[model samples]
Target: MATLLLIEDDLMVRATLRQILERAGHVVIEADHGGEGLSKLEQQHIDLMITDIIMPEKEGIETIIEARRRHPQLPIMAISGGGRTRNMDFLEVARQAGADSTMAKPLRAQQLVDEIDQLLRA
Candidate 1:
């Protein structure tokens, strides 16, 4: 089972993802925003990180960059929804920020798990 750190500002999204991942047999650690997520990264033994793009305090792109600075080998999955994004170039932005992969929001359970499996294989 992979140790996953999930960072999402929306409570409903965070809870849903947590349930899905835990049911899939992974250990999940949740953070409410990028800042808290970053702090958790400093303290937790995370195998992979799944983060949302928009959040208070710190953004996912910034979080990814900061995390990559300290943990280059770490795998990151960046996710974003349609409405709240100020920028249109999410995939490109995340790639530039050093994320291993990006997933669009409102994802299927299997899709999320499968992506994590794929990234781990790499």
Candidate 2:
């Protein structure tokens, strides 16, 4: 079991992810955007983070960068469905920004759980 911070802009996605992580036996802290995620990072002792790329106020890449800077040891997982036009894959950018792992949206539940376990174990 681990404490995970999930930063996502879509309400439905956030709720779904929360359910998934919780079902996997992890405690999840939800954030509507990267700004809120950063604040939560300061307030909570998070074992891992799962963030979306596109968001209001602040983007996941920015969050990843700052989080890495402040908490270099903290593991981060970045997820994205791509840009609205489907031209850009922001997940790569997130990896460059310091995400420990990246997964595309419409993610498979088992893959997510596996990745979380891998990151936490590392």
Candidate 3:
């Protein structure tokens, strides 16, 4: 099992994700925003990161870039419900910013775990 950093602004969504990850045997560390998530990353050993794209303090794109710069070997997964705006696709942006994988919100539990397993294996 991996120790994962789960960065999301929504309380309910974070809780749900925590439950899912914990049930799947991963230790979940939560952060309400990317800034906090980065802080946690600095203080601990995080095996993976699952971040929401449209967070408040620091958004996912910036977070992914900085995290990649700091921890080039760390695996990152970006997730969002609002994947696209008027002319931008945030998930695609996340990929360019250094996310190892991306998934839309309202994520399927099994698929989420499966993707995580693949990322961990890699």
Residue 44 lDDT, candidate 1, scale 0-100:
76
Model 2 lDDT on a 0 to 1 scale = 0.93
Ranking by lDDT: 3, 2, 1
Show pairs that collide, candidate 1: none
lDDT of each: 0.88, 0.93, 0.94
Question: Comparing 1 and 2 by TM-score, which wins?
Answer: 2
lDDT of 2 at 82: 84
> Residue 47 in model 2: shift from native, Å?
0.1
Q: Give the TM-score of candidate 2.
A: 0.97
Off by over 4 Å in 1: 85-88
Name the candidate that leads on lDDT: 3
Q: Candidate 3 — which residues are off by over 4 angstroms?
A: 83-88
Query: How would you encode candidate 3's per-residue C-alpha lDDT over 1-122 as one tens digit per residue?
Result: 89999999999999999999999999999999999999999999999999999989999999999999999999999999983463248889999999999998888999999999999999
> What lDDT is reached at residue 84 by model 1?
55
Q: Give lDDT tens digits, candidate 1, residues 1-122.
A: 98999999999999999999999899999998889998999997998999888778998899999999988999999998844554547857888899999887778889999999999879
* TM-scores of the models, in the order given: 0.94, 0.97, 0.95
Ranking 2 against 3 by TM-score, winner: 2
